[model samples]
Target: MEQKEKQILVSIISSIVILASYSLYVYHKFMAGNPGIINDFRFWGRAFLILIPVAIMAQIIIHIIFAIIHKIVTDEDLSTKNDERDKLIELKSIRISHWLFTLGFFLSMGSQAFGKPPWVMFITLICSGFIASIASEGAKIFFYRKGL
Candidate 1:
C-alpha cells in the first residue's frame, strides 16, 4: 500500500478506536452517577481536550509502526513526497469532507435546539466531525486505489 493510504487507514482506525473507547468509558461513568461526565459541560470540555491528543498520538504511533513494517516487508523506504495526483486526491477528499462537516454541524445544532443535554450536544458534534473525517479518508483511499 502507498504511504498516504497507509497513513489514512491508521488515522481513521485509531481515531475511531479512541473515540469509541472514550465514549464507552464516559457512558460507564454516566451510568455510575459520577458527577461531571455525561451532564457537565466542564467534563466534556476536558474530555475533548484529552481526546484530541490521544487520537493524534495514536495516529502518529500507528503510522510509524506501519512505516517500519512496510519498510521491512518491501525493503524500501516509504516516500515522503507527494505528487500532483496525490494533492488532487487530497483536495477532492477535503471538498467532500467539507460538505459532510456542514451537514453534520447543522444536525448537531438541530439536536442542541431540540433540548438535548450538554453531553448529547458534545457527542453529536464530535461524532459528526469524526464521521466526516473518516469519510474523507475513506474517499482518499478509494481514489488512490482507483488511480487518476
Candidate 2:
C-alpha cells in the first residue's frame, strides 16, 4: 500500500459517501415535499450550502483516517517524499481530470440550454466534480500500479 494508493482509496470512498448522503438528503428534504423542489431556487441554495461544506469536511476526515491507518500499518510517516516519478504520475492524473471537468462544464451548459431545471444543472455540475475527482484519483492509482 503506497501513499498514492491509500489516497485514491480515500478519494473514491469519500466521493461515494458524500454523493450518496447528499442524494438521500435531497430526496427526503426536497423531493418528498408536497409540490416537489425542482423549480425552487431554495433547493439549489440548500444543496450548495449543505453539499459543499459537508463534502469538504468528509474528505478532510477521510484523509485523517488514511493517515492514521498508514501510520499503524507501516510504522512510517504518512507525509510521503515525492520523487520525480510520483510527480509525473500526479501530473498525468491531473491532465485526465482536467478533461473530465471540461466535459462536465459543457454538460451543465447543455442541460441549461435544453431548459432543464436549475436542480438538474446543478446536479450535473456536482456529479461532474465528483467524477473528475474519482477519475483523477483512479488514474493515479493506475499509474502507480502500472509503475508510473
Candidate 3:
C-alpha cells in the first residue's frame, strides 16, 4: 500500500477506536446511571461539546503515534506536503464528507419532526458524523488506489 492509503487506513481505524471507546465510556459513566438523561438537552449538548475537542485531540495524538511507528517500521517519513493531485483528492473526499454530514443533519431534524425523542436525533447525528468520516477516508483510499 502507498503511504497515502496507509495513512487513510490508519485514520479510519483511529476514528473507529476513538468513537467506540468514547461512546462506551459515555454509556457507562452517565447514560447507564440515569437513562432519563438521554432526553436532556443539556446532557446532549455537553456530550457534543466535550466530544468535539476530545475527538480532535485524539486524532492528533493518534496520527502522531502512527507517524512515529510508520517511521520506525519503514524508515521513511510520511509525506507532509500536498501537491496538486493530493489537493484534488482531499477536496473531493471533503466534498463527499460534507454531503453525507449534511444529509445526516437533515435526517436528525426529520427525526425530531416525526416526534421522536431528542436522543434519537442526537444518536442519528452522531452516527451520521461517524459514517461521514469513515466514508471520506475510504474515498481517499479508493482514489489513491485507482490512481485518481
Candidate 1 structure, TM-score to reference: 0.85
Candidate with best TM-score: 3
Show model 1 residue runs off by greater than 4 Å. Answer: 1-3, 27-31
Model 3 spans > 4 angstroms off: none
User: Candidate 2, residues 41-67: lDDT per residue as tens digits?
Assistant: 887788878888888899899888888
For residues 71-104, write the lDDT of model 3, one tens digit per residue. Answer: 9999999999899999999999999999999999
How would the candidate models be sorted by lDDT, starting from the highest?
Answer: 3, 2, 1
Alpha-carbon deviation at 119 in model 3, angstroms: 0.8
Query: What are the TM-scores, per candidate, against the unseen true structure?
Result: 0.85, 0.84, 0.97
After superposing candidate 2 on the true structure, give the runs of residues whose Cα lies further than 4 Å from its correct spot: none
Tell me, by lDDT, which candidate is best: 3
Against the reference, the lDDT scores of all candidates come to 0.82, 0.84, 0.94
